[model samples]
Target: MWISPAFHLKVIRAYDALVTQQPHPGAIDIRDPKQLAIVALQLVEVNRDLQAKVDTMQVAVDAHHRIAKASAGSRCVTDAAKDLQVRPKDLFSWLSANRWIYRRPGGSGWLAYQDRIQAGLLEHKVHTVERPDGTDKVVENLLVTPKGLAKLAVAFRTPNAA
Candidate 1:
């Protein structure tokens, strides 16, 4: 159902040409039945082409949805990086540069930005670690949500994506 911008431009140009009584490449002469039939046939061909493109796009979208659904849980940065086909360090750098994650003021672990967590792109899980003194410390781990993984896949595949 997506109409391309080029198709809209062609329609507008053809309309203007007809209203101005000017001969344009896309303009069809209604006075000639043969020309009108030819234009109708051309339109059928264009419709078929557009439908094919729509079908292809739908398939890609469906595949992405399936992948996102199958994951269905937050994953560590390393696993997400592997799924994205990027180095874990590079992925961490990219996430930091993109403002999706950051290191705490004096902490080594990464933390998700408030906006990213609010947007359901990132999440945090608390882990309890026992120290040598028999004391437990809570550690917060930043993980990427399934939705975030799908978005990252698209962003990584796009040319010139930040």
Candidate 2:
């Protein structure tokens, strides 16, 4: 995947921090963008995995909004006990990279949904029918897989579960 130069720099900075944890003593040149990009990408990738977990947990938490409304606070007293109200921007930032994660735009209603689109959750169905405009054409629908679901599940664990 191609990344912008600014983002590349951001990744490198992150990598430098990680590298500092190890023992390496040598004078090195720093004019290679490709080398830097690789290190940066590696750092970004690790954080991305972490972010996925945060995203899935956010999704599950926000999903409770609907249930709260249905229960009408009869089971709980405090507002915090009633709903999981995660902000939409936070959720989107965590999930935008992976296409299968879907949710509504804000922290309001309970119109949220997520599905694994790779190879484990496996929730897709194929259908071939005439186009909506009545044209003689068919469209393919990609479905999510079980592997994707498992990945999401890993993400949904409590925030500090080590």
Candidate 3:
């Protein structure tokens, strides 16, 4: 149920697009918002596809971690590997292919998808504060407002439903 805020906003925007579509008499029949509808569905489908993969891996990881914990002296990654029996590289490949995770060389996949969601939630406004010691500072999480959600929802909703 841990839906990324970005995808949620995307869905909301898709819904909004459908709701606010104006009839283009010359481009298409006023009775049908074909182009708008098609775009909306595509956005929703992309979100769904990515979400399914994230959910699938999370479930497998969770199961593996649980068993590892019960057995004692098990690290999260070790348990995850055991439960899923997938090589780290392969797992990264899977996550990367879905665009929900990015490869990090020696480290496990980075949660770029989560970062995107956080950025979107913050109203597309982000500030990078650098320290005097030449160290990079962390950015605050973006908050997804109702308006953003509405926009994505409209963009993704079926055209006929509008």
Candidate 4:
């Protein structure tokens, strides 16, 4: 019911044009009631067209959420970040604030939270990487479960944690 300033001006012009038979407004003799009705009908048709578009968009968003929840799974942070088309820093921020991941003293990378690991919502993995100098190093990372991934996705997608 909130009328914008532009729309208010349009309504005023429509009323003036329909009711006052004189184009410049000093009273010409030919007033037609049907002209006012036609203007009102045009406004109703425009409202209906916009409402239809809003309804269709809502249906598509609901379907997307349902599929995202059902298809959640365990994935490495790097891969998950890539799949979501977001920077790794944003994903890490959500993990850190929620305490679903942590870092050990002097630890070089992220680790699974002890509680989530025990609760079967997360797992840990170790892999070896070879450097160009022919040296090998072991790295640790977390594997998030379906339930955990789905919940975390909600947080990461929501704006400002609200």
Candidate 5:
């Protein structure tokens, strides 16, 4: 719908009266569609530039947070695998080779060193499974941390980029 400049001015005046707004804009009234179109184009360009800046800032913030977390130490493997779109076992295999996770003494499973673990990608969980005879047993599992995720990210992304 085409809004006459007079009507637009009246509406603005009414709004100003209602709000008692201060420091009113000094731009002249837009009487022609061509003028409105030009203003619209300028506004669109300004909005696009603003949005682009916001996107850049957001990316920078995300990188900062990720770096902070990655160096903080501590995260699970399974969740990290999910983030990297790989299997937990496969990730663990890579982690073992990378020395992020180490085997415990006396035939026990691996243990994540407290100092080495980075940002937590997932939490360790205990699951109860029922056997055929109606007996339930508990199983505990751990996942890779942020540092591990960072390692996986670098190792996986670098080769694929080529």
Candidate 6:
């Protein structure tokens, strides 16, 4: 319940207006109950307005926190597509069309673009697989980071705005 200096100034101005009966600054008469009541009501009105603004700001902060929580970690493209409410194939196609990802020459797996990886929007997770020949093959999987997921969510919601 911290009151700003500006709010304090507003209350002080209201007190001065009621006491001096003028459009300028002055001290209030502590002995007069009627003047005190008018100033009290003005202060209450100002407080109510400030409270409304604070409540609005609080709601925005809460929404931001919820979005941050929902987009907290990187996920595979399939899981990311589920979060975005789009099919995995559609998501992959969109990413490819938008130049966010691509397949290396003669490769099956998708790879993130260098710029996307540098921008902290995408990442790579490498794994080693054993083939029938008993040899380990290194594979890289592309993943969307939390920041990228949030961006994609907004892009998917808007029509032709991404």
On lDDT, the leading prediction is 1
Residue 71 CA error for candidate 4 (Å)? 7.9
Off by over 4 Å in 1: 1-34, 37-70, 158-162
Give the CA lDDT, 0 to 100, for residue 160 in model 3: 27
Better of 1 and 6 by lDDT: 1
By TM-score, is 5 or 6 better? 6
lDDT of candidates 1 onward, in order = 0.82, 0.45, 0.48, 0.69, 0.62, 0.81
Report lDDT (Cα) of residue 93, candidate 5.
89
Cα displacement (angstroms), candidate 3, residue 48, comes to 2.4
TM-score of each: 0.62, 0.26, 0.23, 0.46, 0.36, 0.55
Candidate 3 regions exceeding 4 Å error are 1-32, 74-162
The residue-level lDDT of candidate 1 at 133 comes to 100
2 or 5, which is superior by lDDT?
A: 5
For residue 156, what is the lDDT in candidate 2? 42
The weakest ten consecutive residues by lDDT in model 2 span 73-82
- In the range 54-102, model 6's lDDT, one tens digit per residue, is 9756654543443465556889999888776678999999999999999
Candidate 5: where are CA atoms >4 Å away? 1-90, 105-110, 116-122, 145-148, 159-162
Q: Evaluate model 3: give its lDDT.
A: 0.48
lDDT of 1 at 161: 27
- Model 4 worst lDDT window (10 residues): 153-162
List the RMSD of every prediction in angstroms: 11.9, 20.2, 23.2, 14.4, 13.7, 11.0
Q: Mind giving the per-residue lDDT tens digits that candidate 4 earns over 1-162? A: 798999999889878888884375544334666766776788899999999998756554543464364446677776666544468888878778878788889977888778988887678888999988999988776877655655555445533221
Candidate 3 lDDT over residue span 60-125, tens digit each: 445444343334331232233333454656544653575534545795325445654554411333
lDDT measured at residue 127 in model 5 versus the true structure, 0 to 100: 86
Model 6 local distance difference test score: 0.81
Comparing 4 with 5 on TM-score, the higher-scoring candidate is 4
